[model samples]
Target: MRDPWVRGLRYLKGNLFSCPPQEALAHCISEDCRMGAGIAVLFKKQFGGVSDLKAQNKKTGDCAVLRRHNRFVYYLITKKKASQKPTYESLKQSLVAMKTHCWENSVASISIPRIGCGLDRLSWEKVSVIIEEVFRDSNIRITVYSL
Candidate 1:
């Protein structure tokens, strides 16, 4: 089997929504489903499923999913509330949850921004390693995007 691959754009570039519709999109959000700032604001404006996501009742370190046509949007619950910052541990747990969802659903590719590193203020170096570690054994390909 081919090894899973994770690569990022050389610089902050590209729109996460620009990826092909077949690919899944993921980003970090609080358990409360408040996507009020940063790239999350754009995600909220584009997807608009706050009620559906809150209905899932996911806790921090879980993954909440929203299905759109043939694609899935993954909301990684890295923190308890939007007002609080996220920890690396919670972010890793959320990634593991997301990875499991990808495996179960046969989602081969996913596009994500530097999760937990934007408004959440976690270090990219640490977050990237956590992401790579969580998905290393899977066949899914991860595309890290920026704006």
Candidate 2:
């Protein structure tokens, strides 16, 4: 186990999609992307499609794990309704679920954007704490991108 807060995590400022691909790319998403904005656009364009994301977002805290271009990407449903922003509790729970899935599946590394900080209107300071707390002792390496 490594201390992700100290040395296991990398914080990079760039487009999340432009970074080198990793085993997984994790980000928060609404139950539906009918509004069409944010990272959903990239997911729709580059990652095959978001139909799976739409299907999986039926419940709050639902996680849609998809394989694209031989890599895994996660869409954590932090928002229950399409119109509402995601809540901190939902984001935390989603991350916990994702962590469990990744550990069980032996995912070595994951790249993520600052989840819940953009359209969801949450604080990165708070969400970062939750992410660090969830993955601090895990063997997986994490890279959080800002764009």
TM-score of each model, in listed order:
0.91, 0.86
Cα shift from native, residue 43, model 2 (Å): 1.7
- Indicate which candidate wins on lDDT: 1
RMSD of each: 3.6, 3.3
| Model 1 misplaced stretches (Cα beyond 4 Å) | 1-12
lDDT of 2 at 102: 92
Instruction: Compose the digit string of candidate 1's lDDT tens values, residues 48-97.
Output: 99999999999999999999869999999988989999999898989999
- Residue 103 Cα positional deviation in candidate 1, in Å, after optimal superposition: 0.9
RMSD of 2: 3.3
| Per-residue lDDT of candidate 2, residues 93-146 (tens digit) | 888888888988888888888788877789988888888888888988888887
Runs in model 2 deviating more than 4 A are 1-8, 33-35
TM-score of 2: 0.86
Question: In model 2, what are the clashing residue pairs, if there are any?
Answer: none
Give the worst 10-residue stretch by lDDT in candidate 1: 3-12
